[model samples]
Each structure stands twice: as C-alpha cells, then as structure tokens.
Target: MHADQRKKLINELTALIKGGNAHVTLSEALSGIPADMRTTIPDNLPYSIWQLLEHIRIAQKDIVDFSISKDYKTLVWPDDYWPQPTDSVTDEQWADSIEEIERDQQRFFALLSDEGKDLFSPLAWGTGQNIVREAMLIADHNSYHIAEIIVARRLLGIWK
Candidate 1:
C-alpha cells in the first residue's frame, strides 16, 4: 500500500479501536455505571458489566502484547481470557481494569502509528499474522464488546 493510504488506514483503525468513531467508546459506556452496578448481572445477560470490562481489558492486553512479543504463548481459552464472574468487584479493581484498558489501547495505537513498522509484514516469529491483521482484530473485538456494554447499560437504565 502507498504510504498515505497506509497511514490513513492506521488512523482509521486506531479510531475504531479506541471508540473515537461512530460507535460508543468504552469510556463512554462505562462512564455512568454506578459502582454498585458494575458487578450486577442484569437478568438474562451471561456476564455483568464488570465481567465484560475485565474481559475486554484482558483480551486487548493479550493481543497487544502478543503482537510485539517474540516469545508469545497461547493463552488458555475462556479461563485465561475472562475474570471470574461475580457481583463483588471492588471499586479499586474496577478502576484498575479501566486504567489497564486505556493504557494498553495507547500501546496498540503507538504500534500502528510507528511509520517504520511494516503493517503487512508477518511477525518474524509468526506464521501468517501481520500487524495490520492484529490491529483490525483488536478494533473489531473491542467494538463488539463495547456495543455489548452499551446494551447492558441501556438495559439497566444507566446509560446517559
């Protein structure tokens, strides 16, 4: 791809991943949720807001770390990707999860923004995966969960 086209793609991917585009950002989705409601499992929902937030935070960190790590190992499915579902996440824990999401998101964006990086080149240690693919995956995955969180908030009548 041309340099300009590549840069444009990077910026668009970053915006989508960071919730800077049309869909609700994770920060916005989490904004009005009271502490008491963070762990409350709305009826018929498989996971609470806290569970979803923690899962998103964990998965995003994993993907970002994997993209840069030469010694990446596969994470255990479901268990390693998700926190224990409970109605007891502490305020500090909730805050920490949010902070981690923001921090790791910046890391993902930094990787994409590095002009020296080849978005199409496969990682030296990986088979067919490339930075561009990983970036798109992160954006798509986060967008899906952000929508889920928004739905949960709306169901609970906490979205504002």
Candidate 2:
C-alpha cells in the first residue's frame, strides 16, 4: 500500500481499538458505575458488568498475545474467554482489568503501526491468520462486547 494509505489504515484501526468514534468507549461506558453495581446481573442478562469487563480484557489479551507471542498457548473456549458470573473482583482488580485492556490495545496498535511487519502476511505460527484479520477481529469483538456492557448497564439502571 502507499504511505498515505498505510497511515490512514493505521489511524482507523487505532480509532477502532480506542473506540468512541461510533460508539461509547469502554471507559465512558463503565464510568460512574457503583462498585456494587459491577456484579449485579440484571434479571434477564447472562452476565454482570464485571463479567463482561473481565471477558473483554481476557479475550483482547489473548488476541494480542496470539498475534505477537511466539510461545502462545491455547486458552479453552467459553470457559477461558468468559468469566464466571459469580466471580467478584476487588476495586483494584477491576481497575487493573481496564488498565490491562487499554495497555494491550496500545500494544496491538504498535503492531499495526509497524510498517516493517506485513499485515497481510500470516504469521508462521498461525494458520492463515494475519495481522489485518486479527485487527478486524479485535475491533469487532471488543465493540460487540462493549455494547453488551452498555446494554447491561442500562438494564441495571446505572447508565443514563
């Protein structure tokens, strides 16, 4: 791709990863939620805000690790990706989870910005998965779950 095109791609990907261009950011969505509200699963919802938060963090970390780690080990499906609804977190743990999500996003953004790495080329360790595909996956996956978090908050009467 041309230099301008490459820069634009990276810029768009960064925005997608950071969110708020077309939807609420993770930070904005989670902000002001009372500590007690974090674990309150609404009547019909499958997970609490805490579960969604940890799930997003875990899944994003897995994607980032798989993208760049040479020694990536597979995490179990559903079980590893989604936290137990009964699992509660300390205030510190909640903050750490959000921090880790943002930090991993920046790490993935760095990978996207590295022109030296071909985004279209599948990593030798991955089966036909490339950085471009992984970028799209993370953007789609995060936005989907983040919206769920927003919906969960609305259901819990915590969001405006």
Best candidate according to TM-score: 2
Which sections of candidate 1 miss by over 4 Å?
none
Candidate 2 residues lying further than 4 Å off, grouped into runs, are: none
Model 1 lDDT-worst window of ten: 13-22
Candidate 2 structure quality by residue, lDDT tens digits, 1-160: 8889889988888887788989999999889999988888988889999999999999999999999977999999989999887745789999999999989998999999888988888999999999988998998999999999999988878889
Worst window of 10 by summed lDDT in candidate 2: 82-91
lDDT of 1 by residue, 1-160 (tens): 7988988998788777777577878888888788889888778888889989988998988999989888888889989998887858788888999999889988888888888888899988888899989988888998898888988888888987
For candidate 1, the clash count comes to: 0
Tell me the TM-score of model 1.
Answer: 0.92
Per model, how many backbone clashes are there? 0, 0
Let me know the TM-score candidate 2 reaches against the reference structure: 0.95
Best-matching candidate per lDDT: 2
* Model 1 Cα shift for residue 157 (angstroms): 2.4
Instruction: Tell how far residue 27 is off in model 1, in angstroms.
Output: 0.8
